[model samples]
Target: MIHRLQNISELIEVSSRMGSDINLIQATGGNTSIKIDGYMIVKASGKHLANAFSENIFVETNPQDYYYNKNGDIKIINPKKSSIREGDLKPSIECNFHALLPKKIILHSHPIEIMAHTMLNSFHSKADLALKGMNWKYINYAKPGEALAMEIAKSMKVDNNIYILANHGLIVCADTVKEAERLQSNVINKLKLNRRVLKDCELESLENIVESIPDAYLPNNKIIHTLGSDEWSLELARKSAYSPDHAVFCGIYPLIIKDINQDWKRLMQGHTYAIIEGKGVILFENSGKYLEDMLLAQAEVFARIPVEESVTTLSINQCKDLVNWEAEKYRKKMLEKLVK
Candidate 1:
């Protein structure tokens, strides 16, 4: 037990660093795991990587413990034999591939640098030149969890250690924690791009939009206002491009208010966020930091994308699949309890 927790501690150290870097991960969006003596300890569903050090946010499981049905739902082989920890916590939905992978250490992250390219329509044509000579394969978009794990498993080769998950993020696998960290840093440095600078946000317009929204909704911060003041970013916010966390936390699309004078709240369209065009951004009432980070993450990803690159968005079906997923709902519920 002590040895396992020791391994978990190392993973937490790696995860804590990853969580603190907004450009790498935000809120409880990413997960980490380490395989030890045939047992794997992975981040719990919807738990914050940043809080792993301070909380019991990992679960012990084996690849053989769970299986996917024809309907693609994950099922435990013997629920009665499952760990007591699993009574309230479970491995991340992404743990399927982690357990099945050949590597001993895995770090899955939503890197802004990598996501910038995955969102690009032209990334496939440009990948060879961008990551030439690297052991990386770009996995096409798939619904998260079992489906995504299988997609990656099919594409993986003996030498491929890094995977660029299209419309998703980056995955780096290694045999040791230090080696994993080193590889991740190399990938980030290699793929990182300079963000397109935005002009200063119009404060008066931002204030006006803030006043128009119900008092319950407030701007997360003055920084997110740049998302609305810029025409291109405002357009990007509407779709948020199917990154699983954004869809799960912030909803499929944001409510766009072209004119604040219109009945804005009624037009929310069930979205938790309202991007007031020409003004700034506002969160729905009772918004949590998870949603806040994802909102800013949406803005960050869209801003880094070049204007000419046609962005790929998740299909309506894809968004529906992620938003309505039972596992995600559990994660959201867990996130609130663990992170706070």
Candidate 2:
């Protein structure tokens, strides 16, 4: 019993620390899990990894077929209770893969550096070279759910642990929390690329336009303005989404206001954010922190892919796949119910 408590405590510590790193996590965008006494304790759908302590953000799922630990493995007869708002918690949509994986500790994260490489047209070769010595594999982008889980299963080898989910994120697995964390750090350091340094925009310049539109406002996070600081990053931001969170949080494509002074309201119709071409980004008053974090993640990802590099953004169909998913709908509903 003491040993089980120790494992759960360690899992919470690692999940909280990883959840707090902006470069690794944003909002409730990532998920973490650990196999304990034959059961999978995974981050609940729409729950913040940072709230592992304050809230019951975990859901315990039993693998119908796969036994977590094979030899004299702990079977924890009565698993820990899993509930939220007097209802049974839902495991992450990505839980299928977690159940299939052999590792005890698993973290599905979206590190900026990994996304940078994913943006490149030739990401497979780059990942191959960067992660040569490590047991790693790069899988093409698949909608998060059973589809993605099946794809990973098709490519995963017995020794493979690091999964570079193209146009998605990274997943590292290990026997213990410490090893999983150490491996995650090593993958980031290995896959890190040189970013295109962007020039800064004078944020004060936007003060003149705030009063023009009733809904328009300058963003609180200064980093979001980087969206318009460079031609490539601005173009990337102007184009389609770089990843799922980008599409789900910020709209598939931000409204591009050629001139912030003109009647830009028509263009912003349903958009959450907008780029004033080369000037900077503007946001609606209700654009929450989750939206801001996703936009900032784009700024970070775009700057890392050199201006000359070829990139691929999600297609309209692909974007629809994510935003329309029932899982995402539930997440949005969950967000609305959380106390601000």
Query: lDDT per prediction?
Result: 0.76, 0.78
- lDDT per residue for candidate 1 within 20-94, as digits (tens), equals 889888877888888888888888887778877787778888755544434334342432244335557777888
TM-score of each: 0.90, 0.89
lDDT value, residue 317 of candidate 2 = 92
Query: 1-340 in candidate 2: lDDT tens per residue?
Result: 2354356888889888988888999878888888887777778888888888887777777753322333534221212232212255677778777877889999899999998888889888887887888998888888876677767877877699999898889999999889999999999999889876786777667667666777888876776787886777787786778898888888787777676666556655667667877678888766765777787788888879887788988888999899887888888777767736
Candidate number with greatest lDDT: 2
Model 1, which residues run further than 4 Å from truth?
Answer: 66-87, 262-269, 338-340
Q: List the residue pairs that clash in candidate 1.
A: none
State, as a TM-score between 0 and 1, how close model 1 is to the true structure: 0.90
